[model samples]
Target: MPMNDADAHVAAQIRAVLAAAEAGGGVAPIVEAGDPILRQTTRPFDGQVDDAELAQLAEVMRATMLAAPGVGLAGPQVGIGLSMFVAEDPGSLDPETAEVRQRSPMPLRVVLNAEYTPATSENVAFFEGCLSIPGYQAVVARPRSIELTGVDLNGTPIAEVVAGWSARIVAHETDHLDGIMYLDKAEMRSLSTNTSVAKFWNQPSTQQAASELGFTLPSSMLL
Candidate 1:
């Protein structure tokens, strides 16, 4: 049965509180793709960062994301639609050279009421898997650069143009707040099971998938 407004609110509060109280602020279970929450837009967060409940929720989200080992996560993925998400990318890999790129690790960041726009016309494809989706991945074509704007946990304004892998993470988490999933933009033919990806398509770039699996690479991703 679908949740009513009051029931959903109560459930969200309970989840946030329980997630906050778990030892070390344990990871929350990610809501799966078919959940209504994942498909709906989130409400604005009007609560102050200093608010005890809000801070606790943030901590819980951070703990959960790191525990899941995901670079980004959205509130809806955790059964809340509070226009909140967290992201942190520890490193990057150069797809062609198989070289680890040196980039500053983003400490856990909370983006609320986030907005993103393409910073460039170029599109690139890459294999993306969502925590909610579990064991499947797909090649998604996304803008190569993005201008992201949002508020931090403390409600501080953030505005920046980001590119490369960083831009991908930003666009991804922001899309969650907008009721979009990578699958919605993914190449249908490029879908693969996680096991298949590990055995066949799990290279640094999307190029391997194009050649091995007959997936189409966005022009920007072509050599």
Candidate 2:
């Protein structure tokens, strides 16, 4: 597909950011919540960026995510309105936290044009945070499992059934492509600062947080 004017402008901006990062030997600066790019629907990953550029972008994105020490990152978070993201999890939680959150390790994955659907009726509420929205966390009820489909940088197809914390990561990152932030779906009353979360709400499950914060989780999770 040909790049429309708006997409062309975005592509230029993306290439410029990549070039600056390569020249400066620094990671891409993550854009914060108020950026218009983060609120815009992303363009599909056509050939707007060449293979070499795409590879460089991926490398830079990976480096940025690691530097941010975040489990996932999206294009919009870096000021590129493109449907792409990288995700990985070391799964280094303690046994109790791991068991309660169903968190497991995930190898680094770069997904383009991603989309997901709920794989089960069950919903889980957790204190989810985002790189774009730094310093705050909120309780969000999301499907416990999801069917994810997308393509890789090489244009290879990607399809998988993701569950547990990985599923939440997938949903969260994919939502970025559609101009959706986790805050849009979060329980407003359950919002907490990072310090507060560490001090008061750092539990394996969100049940206590929900109770004390005066918010409710999905009824499905109550069963």
Candidate 3:
């Protein structure tokens, strides 16, 4: 889809800020939950955010995500209410041993005005975390596979079928664009502090959360 003109002046201001961040400036502050910005539905990037400006935003966001050491970040998290988000999961690691588990790797990528369709009836649940909602995780369930559609910074289209952790990351970030957070889909009783997660629910699968944590995990997620 094509973009229209938004507040042109707002666009210019953001362009300059993003450019500065791209040039080794400070990372944009992440907005936390209960902030009105995170609750507001983001608008599609109008012509106001030109391709060059969009590219700069992507770079800065990527840098911030890597610096935060998170697998995903969204525009709203950075106080930009635009329909854009970034996600990358190179692999998983053992925090104690620093041993990397070769999970499916997703290189850094940005998607704008993203939309997705569930490609499978099966559901997958995992203990997911977020940058905005730091130091905690919850069991969130979603389609095991999905067809994601969106655009890059250059106004081109992007479409792909993704599965595993990649699908979870895509679903989580796109939810931010829609003013939705992972907590919305998370099993409330399964929520845990980071330390609690490490202690009680840090098993190979969330199937243990039900028995050890005394929470209900959907049967579909048990493999």
Candidate 4:
């Protein structure tokens, strides 16, 4: 599908942001995964949104997701350790080609330091990946619908209901900024699809990281 003017504009902005990050001038700075900041639940910024910084973040997220080959990306995943994520609306798939194509339905929404409340008790499971953990994926259970409240990239407050895959995307990315991984909420070994988890664990450092993180490998993660 042809992109509209607004969509095209956002795409262009995303590209520019990513380019700057690649040049080492866009993102604020990198933080280690186990840093204290990553563990705390992210709080909404009280002051006005800095358009320049927010724009850079959105661009970095977009670029990071594209580079990592994932549908969504959060700020912490890129090492910025902030309450932000840039996600393509999971429901906006383009059915024209063999490869899946999706766009942000709300024109690149930037949920800043958001909080999520499930609107429905109905739960669903989906395959999820992370930009922080490259070359791995898992089947994680998530709420089918949610009521999320947060400020946008421009710092405008929003409290809206979302359903389908969009809710999942938002919830998954939000957790990243809070330093929570999907494995933290996963129910069983089958939810994990990390094919290389065993191999990676065979190495001493990787094994140590897994052990330190308290991640157990699932024998079989899929049906």
Supply every candidate's count of residue pairs whose N, Cα or C atoms clash at under 3 angstroms.
Answer: 0, 0, 0, 0
What lDDT does model 4 reach? 0.59
**129-169, model 4: which lDDT tens digit per residue?**
66555556554667767899888866688899977667878
Where in model 2 is the C-alpha error above 4 Å?
none
Q: Rank by lDDT, descending? A: 2, 3, 1, 4
TM-score of each: 0.85, 0.95, 0.86, 0.63
Q: Relative to the true structure, how large is the alpha-carbon lDDT of every model?
A: 0.76, 0.90, 0.78, 0.59
Which residue pairs in candidate 4 collide? none
lDDT of 1 by residue, 1-223 (tens): 5666754684466466455448444667778889988888777676423357677677777777878778888888878877888888876554452242213456667888889999999887777889889899898877878899888777799898887767778788888887899999998788899899889875667676788777777676678
Best candidate (score: TM-score): 2
Tell me how many residue pairs clash in candidate 4: 0
* Poorly placed runs, candidate 1 (over 4 Å): 1-25, 48-50, 93-104
Off by over 4 Å in 4: 1-37, 89-107, 191-223
Tens-place lDDT per residue, model 3, 153-222, is 7778988888877888889999999899999998888889999989887776777786776776557755
TM-score of 1: 0.85
What's the distance in Å from true for residue 55, model 1?
Answer: 1.6
| Candidate 4 lDDT trough over 10 residues, lowest sum | 95-104
Return the TM-score for candidate 3, rounded to 2 decimals.
0.86
